[model samples]
Target: MKILVVDDDPNILELVSIQLNQAGYTVQKATNGFQAMELLEEELPDLAIVDVMMPGMDGYTLTRKIRAYADIPVLLLTAKGELEDKEKGFLAGSDDYVVKPFEPKELLYRINAILRRYDKAVDVFIQAGPLKINRQSYEVSVGKKVLLLPLKEFELLSVLASKVNTVFTRDMLIERIWGYDYEGDEQTLNVHIKRVRGKLENLTGEVTIATVRGVGYKLEVASI
Candidate 1:
C-alpha cells in the first residue's frame, strides 16, 4: 500500500514516513498541502496522513479537497486532542484520526483496521465458465488453477470484475482505479485492461471486456 504524509514539521514528516515505510508501505512526504496536491498529479496514495497544523492549506482543507472526488481514506495526525477538534476533522472528511505524539504502532493499527473494513472477501470465487476470480485475494483462476497477476493488472481487473456489465468509460476507469489525483494516462490503463483480457482467453464469454463503441469497456455479465 502507498501512504502520503503531509506535515510542515520536518521531524514529524521524516518520522512518519520512515515508520510507515518500515511497516511495509511505500511512503511519500510533502512539507505542505500545496506539495501534497502536486504529488497527487503523480498518483494518489492508498491513504493520507495529514497534520492539522501547517503553514498554508492546513490538513482540514486538504482533506476536503481530496474527498471532493476520491474515496481514498484520510487520517488526521494532529496535536490538538479536543473533542471539538476531532469533530471538525470529521467534518472536513477524514475516515480516521490519530493524535500527535502518538506511537507509530498506534497509527499502524488504525491503518490496518481501516484497510480491513475496505477489504473484500476474495474467498468468494466468481466464475463464468472456465474462468474464476477470487475477489478477496485478487487472484484470477482458470479452472482449478489461479494465475499470478501484477499489481496494476490486478487492480484493473478488480475494478472491472467488481462491476460486471457496467460500461465504464476510460476516464471513469482512470478515476476508479487510479483515483482523482492520478497523473497517469488513460491509455496505460487501457493497455492493462487488455492484458487482463489476454489472461481470460479460456473463458467462453465473448469479449468479457465489452467495448462500447466511442465510450469504453465493460466486463460482460453472465446470463442466468
Candidate 2:
C-alpha cells in the first residue's frame, strides 16, 4: 500500500516516511499542502498522513480538498490533542487524528486501522462461476479445491478476477499490479499470467483467463 505524508517539518516527514517504509508501505513525502496536492494529481495514495498546521493550506484544507476529489482516507497528525481540534479534523474530512509525540507503533496501529476499515469497505470476496477469490485472505478456490498462488500471481489473478469479462489492457494491469513506477516490460506480466493460468487450469475448466489478442486479457467463465 502507498501512503502520502504531508508535513512542513522536514524531521517529522522523514521520521514518518521511514517508519511507514519500514512497515512495508510505499511512502511519498510532501513538504506542505501544495506539494501534496501536486502529488495527488499524479497518483492517489491508499491513505494520506497530513499535519494539521502548515504555512499555506493547512491539513484541514488539504483534507477537505482531498475529500472533494477522492475518497482516500486521511489521518491528521498534529500537536493538537483537545477535543475541539479532533472534531475540527473530522469535520475537515480526516478519518483519524493523532497527536504529535506519538509512539511509532501507535502511529502504525492507527494507520493499519484506517486502512483495514477502507479495505473492508472496498475489498471483498469475489466470485465468478465456480471460482472464488477472498481478497482479505489472498485465497483462490474453485468449488471445493483451493489453489495456492505466488504473491505476484495472486495479485495478477485478483486484478483480473475483480472485473470478470472486462478486458484489462496490459498497461492497466502493469500500473495496478506492478505500480505506476514499474520499470519492467509486458513480458514480466505475461510470465505471471501464464503461471496464474497454469494454477487455475489445475482446479477447474469453468474459469479461464482469455488473451484479447493484441489488446490485453480478461477473466471469462464458461456457462455451466
Candidate 3:
C-alpha cells in the first residue's frame, strides 16, 4: 500500500515516512497541500496522512480537495485534539483523526481499520423492495434508474438495506459508518440520514427509511 504523508515540519514528515516505510508501505512525502495535490495528480496513493496545519492549504482544505476527485481514505495527523477540531476534520471528509505525537502502532492500526472498512466487498448485493444495492460496484438502482449517491449516503443505505426492518441505533450507525473514535455528534448522523431519506424517497416509494421513536432507524420494504 502507498501512503502520502504531508506535513510542513520536515522532521515530523520524515518521522511519519519512516514509520510507514517500516510498516511495508510506499511513502510519498509532500511539505504542503499544494505539493500534495500536485503529487496526487502524478499518481494517487492508497491512503493519505495529512497534517492539519500547513502554509497555503490546511489539512481540512486539502482533504476536501482530495474528496472532490479521489475516493481514497484520508487520515488527519495533527496536534489539534479538541472535539471541534476532530468534528471539522471529519466534516472535511477525513476517514480518521490522530493527534500529533501519536504512537506509531496506533497510527498503523487506525490506517488498517480505515482501509479495511473502505475496501470493496467481493460479492455482496442487497435487494430491498424496488432498490438494488451492489457493494462491489458502489451502485444503487431501482428498476432501470440508477442513483449516484455520496459515499456516506451509500454506506448508510447499504448497512440499512443489508437487514430490512432491522433497527440500528444512532450510536451503532455512527460507529459503523464513521470510525469508533469519531468525535462528531448525533447531528451529523441525523443530517446524513435525512439526506439519504430524501434521495430514497425520490428513487422509490416502496422502500423507506423508518425512524424508530427513541431507538434509531430501519429500512422497510413494502410487501409486493
Ranking by TM-score: 2, 1, 3
**Per-residue alpha-carbon lDDT of candidate 1 for residues 1-224, written as tens digits (9 for 90 to 100):** 67889999999989888887665567889999999988977897878888999887988999998888577789999899999999999999998899878987778777766654454422255554445677667677665667878877876676566546666567556654655467877678768877878876654454377778776777875564
TM-score per model over all chains: 0.58, 0.62, 0.55
User: How many Å off is the CA of 95 in candidate 1?
Assistant: 0.8
Model 2 gets an lDDT of: 0.85
lDDT at position 220, candidate 1: 79
Candidate 2 lDDT over 1-224, as tens digits, reads 67999999999999999988766568889998999999999998989999999998999999999999899999999898999999999999999988999998778777767765675578688888888888778789876788878888987887688667877677667766766567988999989989888888899988999999977899999986
Q: Give per-residue CA lDDT, model 3, range 87-153, as digits (tens).
A: 9999999999899889977787787678657654422778888899988788899989999889999
The C-alpha local distance difference test score for the whole of candidate 3 amounts to 0.86
Q: Comparing 1 and 2 by lDDT, which wins?
A: 2
Q: What are the lDDT figures for the candidates, one per model?
A: 0.75, 0.85, 0.86
Question: By summed lDDT, which 10 consecutive residues of candidate 2 come out lowest?
Answer: 112-121
Give the clashing residue pairs of candidate 2, or none: none
TM-score result, candidate 3 = 0.55
In terms of lDDT, which candidate is strongest?
3
Clashes of 2: 0
Candidate 2's TM-score reads 0.62
